[model samples]
Target chain A: MHSDTKAPLALKLSAIGGLIFLLAPIALIFLYAFTTEEKSYQFPPPGLTLKWIGVTMGRDDVWQALGLSLKVAAIATVLAMVLGTLTAAAVARSRFFGREAISLLVILPIALPGIITGISLRSAFALLDIPFSTWTIVLGHTTFCIVVVYNNAVARFRRTSGSLIDAAMDLGADGVQTFRLVILPNIGTALMAGGMLAFALSFDEVIVTTFTAGNQSTLPIWMLEELVRPRQRPVTNVVAMAVVLVTVLPILAAYYLTRDGAETAGSEK
Target chain B: MTSPAIFAPRSGVLARAADWAIRHPRMFVFLMVLPIVLWLGIVYIGALIALLMQSFFSIDEFSGVVQHEFTLKTYAELLRPSNFAIIARTVAMAAAVTLASAVLAFPMAYFAARYARGKWKALFYIGVMLPLWSSYLVKVYAWKLVLAKEGILTWIFAQLHLSWLLDAVLAIPVVGGNSLSVSYLGTFIVFVYIWLPYMIIPVQAALERVPAPLLEAASDLGATPKQSFRMVLLPLALPGIVAGSIFTFSLTLGDYIIPQIVGSGRLFIGQAVYTQQGTAGNIPLAAAFTVVPIVIMGVYLWGARKMGAFDAL
Candidate 1:
């Protein structure tokens, strides 16, 4: 593309401004984590200290919340992988009645407001007399996480060749063998990316967890409580910084993994 | 990989079961879809139906218990002046947020889609996504700090001799409060900040679909750059914009926490539902309030489908 066809200077500047708007608040969280002043958000901190980091680490509730979040994300990611991959295979490779409706059903959990999912599950649990526990949170997380993995896996599955399975079978391979040798390897990265995204989503999920988690506190819920009733402002900031790292790392890893191979093959079209 | 498959017993039960599944492909598909069906059907659809049922039921006013018999009494309550204000305010806020995000996101998406090179493209992806995937609650809280009375924004305005400018803006009528942190404006800003990336991704995707060659073809056929953008580019990006708007609009309509943390005492629909169920103990009315977003989004999505927005999404 020529300079004339490239993005105009004003447009480039506007994009930079947009990026700054998106990032500045997150950047402030990291900055304020080390602020010496505990009472407020200061322009330039009176002084910088590592005090909040130690304070946040010593808090038992923070650790417990973090542990619960990690546990829920792990379980939800595994469940989503199985459910999402199977559904994706069914939708992508087979001709089924109401396939489009099934696809729409998978997306609805995510596309709707989280509060609706939250309250609906809360009421359903009430009606069924199912106690709200870690499993309830897992159920809520899996409901939306399935969409992430299905979107990834179905795209990859469509791009994958059907003849590869036929060729494997022609070489005297059974269904298990064909899937093990052909399908898994082919869709593995996309599945991994999907799983990673699902994990990240579950890690930081708050609104649904608020309704489904009866007595449990995930990290985001913990942060919410702290913000509403702050013991020390910077402590939440430190936790927020850590939460950013935990969620962002997997998403970045997913991006890198997906951008290179068959994972993004369908999207490029 | 080959060794495990080769060493597996050919005539064994596992092999036979796999072979059986292969032979009955329809059954295989059914089995694959069965768990998803049960999960979604029992959990999602059943839950929705339950909510709808609760909405039709009325609450005993004095006893404060849900009377589960079918009635339109709760929905009639939704039309009450106070309850209707919550729905109207929430819808208005959601529409404003969606429009602001769309206006702000278009140029950025255009830049990323059109001219970003390898490293820049990677930066654009990670940059938008990092903020996107981070803890949403934390970002909203961070906005509280940024917009607080003695926060960095005020400090910046003071440094630039623009304190009165900030004051003048905050001195307005309905939306204003004591400060930005407690104003409706603050909630609106935080909402746009949080959901802005949802708008960006799809629009960038749509714009990326309009390849360079196509634009060049349009220009070569005697169209100016502006004309090419209007005639060639706008049509391609509209679906993506509409797609992003669905996310921004619906997410805003359903959010409760932002108003609690950052706004004035006005209630959004989500907060109304939350408090009705939790604090007010009015489950029936809460269910009725929940239906508002559901109906709005159902209609909005159906309309967008007609406009072919889901293709970009």
Candidate 2:
């Protein structure tokens, strides 16, 4: 109580410092994306323009990479959601002998170092003679993505109140009917949050994608290529900004959907 | 969450099917896990084994195909000081990031879980989480602008007349920074920034479970705010700190993108593995290198479980 008034001033300063640090790099890109001096990393460029955006739009490779990233992320998230939901439902709702082990197994992909997962997937693909392709990337992404969906679904399941399911059943609803009507509605926000987060994770994933992707480059892989090769710096910044927006927007949405009062109560479970 | 009764017993044909389904849950779960398990086994396990076996066998120096004969050459080669240095560097970087993130996260998590009211808490939580959505590559790339020769940080230093202080810090001998160069320090700063949120959220979740009344009771017993934190909060939050550290540690250790973009080409084991696999085309060695992180992680996870990380989450 004593510090409430005393705290606000310090807290305000800290919050402002936090905000600046959080935004500085992101904001810098906005300044650079318009810089007319293309060839170097000079501060306070003599001229500023939107010329780089136009240059970036003209690049076919950027578009192709963007398309591939979208496809891979979408497919991986969908796969993760379907499998994760079924697994979460089975494990969360039932009594099983090795449930703990299964639950741990479900979480391990995302939990273990991405390097371990990446190398494991790469070796396994090699054993199967599976070449690095879009499919391999999707498989790699789904392994981690499943963890996100499973976590959300399980949390939502825990919060739905078992009595509601019993109420539906006692009223003569069948298992499918109850699940379709009652269960889905209750966990919809969690599922959506999970899907959004999973998609964002998969979209930006580079380490695992590096191992799984052979020659085909996603936007991140392309950016990696450009970072190593200096001639494409401006285009890289453009694509980087695009990535900042795409990955950031969903994360913001996920936070709001998950942190809104409704979801905070769900989080308590 | 599920009633567990809806699927218990019923008289109709649908109930009969449900009963049959419940009885055959093993098969259903197996079916659900089959694709992923197969993928994990074939891809991950095979790579790991291939990597291990490759270390035991020699690579044909001329061809690099990994010869058929089993020998201890690669393992012996890996035992060298240079090779060991890479592992040490990686561990050091990871440790620095994890430690820094934990320190930075504590105050923020404390504020949110204990002090903030209503919407402000959610806003803080959201603030902590938003950076997570940004693509890892872009985030790493962003630091280039921060730490580069003429980047914004430099500009700010000039404006504040703090360039001399920065120059002195940068002049520290071991860090190899008489001036700001994109190296280990740059990598460390970004790693800490990027992984800080992972630590904060879990620590906040852990702190929330302390129960407000417990803190009130401690305060009533005449503990100062600082004393209350040490006595009541830290012990309650220890498990979460451990759990969150595992995430931060493992992520930092395995992050090839950040190191590749921000660190020097030969800076860490992540890069070593990438180069071995991609450039050197020594898949087995890359696989073998992956073992180091997996072993460390397995141990850390076991430790976390022993510390009751599950309940904390």
Candidate 3:
């Protein structure tokens, strides 16, 4: 807030440069999506067209992958919300034995590198005879997704004073009534923010999905395969541009709902 | 956020159960925690334990079947020079990325934390989150295109008469390659690009929390601006820096797809693990390989925690 603390000219320039470095590649996706050159990248397109969008839309496999990703993200988000809210509700007020370790356990999925989570879940599936399927992907996603919800929910739960619940109970409300009238409204936006963030993570997850998806293709896995083996390169860019636009909505929603604007950052890794 | 209408005051058995759960706080807590404990503890922790166990089991070199008996064979494989090189390469790249990310992130984080107000702050956040929420694979793939020999970066350098500079850099030994897309340098660029936001958000957050008065206090004590920054700001922001580096470093260490898409044919730890488990059916070896990052991140996090990074995180 002080004049002396203002960033110098060099610092301001570097900040702009840094932002450009981050945003330029995302801009490149949109550029290439309109490129007429189908097979390889060129510095500037020989020509420009919107035909790849139509071509990508025509691909059946693309539709299937999109459908699968939506389904998995939806299921994972719901499961994360349930488990995360329960854990938060229990953990927010309790100082039970091993509480620190329990909190660590809750965070472990997001804390460790995703590869560890991926392979561990892959092995556990083999050990337990769970078939590689949509449900398998959902489980892998839910493991990490829970932490996002837990992070958001627990913070809100802590902030929502104990007096509100007590006040509701003293006013002759039953347990369900107190929960419905008092607790739900207080924590609803936090849970919404958490669920939205969870959905975004699940929708775009690739590394963990790589291990658990077996032969199935979520949208990210499909995009990865397409990049590795390009059938129509421009189409991939088009699809990527579309994915970026679609996923942006949920992230924006999460940012909007969280009371602390930066709350969505809690489990971003 | 769901309807939860099932818990509505309906009737007999369900009503009694709800009433009972409400009456006993401890019992309610136990019941509430039961599903989470089972899901995280049994399913998630059980999976981790399974991985650790598999790392102790060896593979049959002849039949290709996994041997159930406990052995040091897989961990031994990790010590083999070829496998050890992969670990070293991944760790080196991870370190470089984290360092570069912190350097690049700091100025932006500083600007955002100190000077940006209202709409500009919102725009700064959106800039970070847009890249993050966008498809991870797509971002990596975009870099591949951008760094291709025929890509715009080359075009820009050519336009600026800097083609010789790029060629000179590309002529260097290991980090160089036929093109930027296939170089170790390229892998480093992509890693730094993708993980920079992870670093910025934390560092910006940490910086924002340090009151302006702290800086004024240092200045008021006759400290030069540079001295105040070194003495007062850096230590205060260390935790946030460490928190961000943990993500950048760990993400770089464990990523397979970036190297697969953009780097030279050399294997990173992620690729090694992926191939061993996915293609070669060497489950034990793959599990053992994973232990490298787990151990590295574990030690790094422990060190970071001691530096108070947990507060920033």
Give the TM-scores of the predictions, in the order they appear. 0.90, 0.83, 0.91
Q: Give the number of the best model, judged by DockQ.
A: 3
Docking class of 1: medium
lDDT of 2 by residue, B173-195 (tens): 65545335456677788888788
RMSD of each: 4.4, 5.6, 4.6
State how far residue A97 of model 1 sits from its true place (Å). 4.6
Alpha carbon lDDT at A110, candidate 1: 82
Q: Judged by TM-score relative to the true structure, which candidate is superior, 1 or 2?
A: 1
For residues B52-78, write the lDDT of model 1, one tens digit per residue: 778899999898888879899888899
The list of candidate 2 runs beyond 4 A from truth reads A1-5, A8-16, A93-101, A155-189, A251-269, B1-30, B41-76, B114-123, B178-181, B208-233
Q: Rate residue B33 of model 1 by lDDT.
A: 92
TM-score of chain A of each: 0.88, 0.88, 0.90
What tens-digit string does per-residue lDDT give for candidate 3 at A92-124?
Answer: 976666566667888898877788888888877
Candidate 1 — which pairs collide?
Answer: none
Candidate with maximal TM-score: 3
Interface RMSD of 1: 3.4
